[model samples]
Target: MENQSKKVTLFTPVKLGKFELAHRIVLPPLTRMRTVNGFIPNDWMVEYYSQRATKGGFLVTEGTVINETGHGYYGAPGIYTDEQVAGWKKVTAAVHEKGGIIFNQLFHVGRQSHRSLQPNGAEPIGASAIPHEDLVFTQQGWVPAEPNRALETAEVKALVKDYHQAALRAMEAGFDGVELHGANGYLIDQFLQDGTNHRTDAYGGSMENRVRLMIEVLEAMVDVWGSDAVGIRLGPSGTFNSMSDSDPIALFGYAAERLNELDLAYLHLIEPRINGNIEIADGLEPVASMHLRGIFKNKMIAAGGFDQAKAEDILEKGYADMVAFGRHFIANPDLVFRFKNGIPLASYDRETFYGGNEKGYTDYAFYEAYADA
Candidate 1:
């Protein structure tokens, strides 16, 4: 009874734009490299997502690259092809049959790529021609990223069109909506941060310039799906993929204000501690999301190592409208039920997280099965 009472705070239905969620628990976009043939969402991907689609809950698909050149990792899915669209339709159908609302996260990994992953051995594109020193996993193996070339002004506009087209493809694939992957040091993040984007054009340098690409992309996406069906993920002060801003609070605060004016579906902000799956920096009195919550006047979702108790606390305090679970959901398909009933979650295997078969993907036992064992 105590657990049930505590669960009420997190389980209450909330309005997120046009969708009324059954609960505030969100399954965040996790990059599981299970797509077959490098770009198609296969049968395993269908089974994988359907298992985690709890009725009345929200689930965002793994990062689906908008363009072939945007792909950085092996086995990640893409949305630009007709075959990929057909493949995702199966997954979305399965989730919808279970009464789960799913969103496809559109992505582009700017400079976070190797020549092996790019088309025709082309260099990866970014806001500048800077080289990222991080290693990325490819078909060949983990290789160091090559120096990227800055996208020309014409190319930038074309990339925005790519995002717009991807959103339309997501709709055709039967997604409930689309979430732009604007966080985690990806393409949009690369342009937004000063450390990577060193250009003096309209898409770099000043905060407005740095944020232009994302805003323009968002506007393009909104045109396709309407503002009510679009959401954006952001990581303010996130240092993943060697990314950092000159002044994150100022840059992100201004961005949030602009986003608020757009009246998009929601703003998904990853907590500073969970930046790029690594704890890079600390010592900010108030966290990034906390500061942005005061500035952005829209439904906000906060994610980053949040447990049920902490999630409940934040919801009760009105810090965010929803809480997204990542690793917890990875190991526990019925995470909402486990949290509500106080059931022990199954432990996850770290080795089988990325590119694997069914071992760590769909084999995690539910609470009932675990109890029987």
Candidate 2:
């Protein structure tokens, strides 16, 4: 009876590396593409982040591009420029004002881009010159991703430097920590998975060479912010942006075990149920977090398709220390409070998920428990 009654509570406090949260719920990065011209965060972005902030809660900002050529969509925020850094300062301040811990999720979209989004119309750089019909949203509307050139050995090193500089700028922007976007078939994922990485160079042709870029990038980030302040997000079975791996379990297991040496903030895992940002019915591929929990052996945050019951269950079973809600947080600004108080959540409108003003962005209301009293 005692063992059966030992129900885990999401309202309880949990320590995640350098920070201690009042609750176990986390707001993961969600790219809404609502930044201003030149990919700068505006007042609307400030209010949006501020609205979601809670005392001692955690918020991971959307995948802020590290460089211009690394961008895959227009209006997606960047942290590379001085002006962009200034824009993010406002955002970080807003979240901090609410006493919320925030991290900048820095990334490069890799081959998930078109020539139009590149510098001087140069082909987007990736692990290799792989091309596919994975649509990247551009100024001209949804178009198939264009051919990308393989990054030379020297160019790969330069991109690691880019990540280091971006980490510095993120700290300058007043973010509490940083999460390297190594998932979702982005630059890092393109290097890790065999489907996208077809290079015979030192950066590929073997799992060590393939994972080297991501490991080096994380090492660079740790140099800026201590190991305790850095986190990594990975998706083992995620096929988003045409991603695949011949041996996901072996590849991801080795990567997770390697990550344990860093003693980083957390390993945020995206479930195989999630394809990119949306939930999908994937045939029995196994949950990525379940497969990786024991191997990573550090703080882990499981994301993708989690609700109140599911989130509590994961914590009870010790699969992840916290749960990240992207789509749910979009509709419920006071999501942490809702979870704490056992209140019903509002459903989100998928049509207004991307490239919108205040419709599905910041207009979500808080739960009114004592209305008409």
Please list all clashing residue pairs in model 2, or write none if there are none. none
Q: What digit string (tens of lDDT, one per residue) describes model 1 on residues 141-203?
A: 678888889899899999999999999999999998999998888899988889888988899
Write candidate 2's Cα lDDT for 1-373 as tens digits: 0122455567778787789899878889898999858999998899999988988998999999999889898779999999999999999999999999999999999988988889899888899887677888888777888888888899899999999999999999999999999999999999999999998988887888889998999999999999989999998888888898999899999989888888888999999898876779634333776778778877889888888878878777777778899999999998887776778889999988878688889888878862221
Could you tell me the lDDT of residue 185 within candidate 1?
82
Candidate 2 differs from the real structure by a C-alpha RMSD in angstroms, to one decimal, of 2.7
Q: If scored against the real structure, what TM-score would every candidate get?
A: 0.94, 0.95
Question: Which ten-residue region of model 2 has the weakest summed lDDT?
Answer: 1-10
Clashing pairs in model 1? none
Q: Each candidate: what lDDT? A: 0.85, 0.87
Task: Please give the lDDT score at residue 26 for candidate 1.
Answer: 93
